[model samples]
Target: MVLVEDALLLAASAFIVTSFVGLFRVVRGPTMPDRVIAINVVGSNVVIVIALLAAAVGEPGALDIALVYALLNFLLSVAISKFTVERGGVL
Candidate 1:
């Protein structure tokens, strides 16, 4: 039987892989908005991965780190969107 910790790790791995794939969009996006959205997606995925790893390890402190990361990701996305808008990229 698959243990809970093992399952969480597997899910985290899958998210990490998907996040890497998202990086390709950031690298080759045709527009600044596209790149910004891709970066946000990857950042969100990282937060999820961190949370999952924290759960797997039974570390509550890591959850706090994940929360901080999520807040930072939100701020980054907003900042990037504002910059893109100022630069004439559509929201």
Candidate 2:
């Protein structure tokens, strides 16, 4: 179990680092879609980290929250994409 936890932590750390890299794209994006992609990456990382924490701490509520966050992320992404498409060619 300890080994499993260690692996999970390592995986979480890697994802977090990737997320930070994605964060740069959010600020330096050349296009609106690029920024949106970066934001989505961050949201995915959040979901992963939350799930890791829930497992590490044995908190079921955290898992529920993670699930909710994942759903919200997907819904928000779709809404943003639709709005961007409807808008007069990307703000």
Candidate 3:
């Protein structure tokens, strides 16, 4: 069980580290959609990491927080996409 927990921690850390690579796209993406996708990826990855950490730490509250974060990320992504489409990518 300990080994499994440790593996989960390592996996979560690995996910977070790789998510940083998406930052390049967010910062210097050739187009607006590319940047939006990158940001969405980072947000999803963060939710995964948070859930994993919650499991590793045996904290139900952390999982709740992760769920809320996921919801917010999803809503924000949709809102941004809609705004981009409606405003020709101005906002």
TM-score to native of every candidate shown: 0.94, 0.87, 0.92
Q: What TM-score does candidate 1 get on C-alpha atoms?
A: 0.94
Candidate 3, 1-91: lDDT as tens digits: 9998999999999989879988888999988999899999999999999999988988879998999999999998999899899988754
Point to the candidate with the largest TM-score: 1
How far residue 4's Cα lies from its native spot in candidate 2, in Å, is 1.3
lDDT (10s digit) by residue, model 1, range 28-79: 9988888988999999999999999999988989999999999999999999
Q: What is the lDDT of residue 84 in candidate 3?
A: 91
Candidate 2 has a TM-score of 0.87
Q: How far is candidate 3 from the true structure (C-alpha RMSD, Å)?
A: 2.0
Candidate 1 — number of clashing residue pairs?
0
Model 2: runs farther than 4 Å from truth? none
Give the 10-residue window scoring lowest on summed lDDT in candidate 2.
82-91
What are the per-residue Cα lDDT tens digits for candidate 2 across 20-61? 999999999899899888889999999999899788766878
Report clash pairs, candidate 1: none
**Model 2 / residue 11 / CA error / Å:** 1.1
Clashing residue pairs in all predictions, respectively, total 0, 0, 0
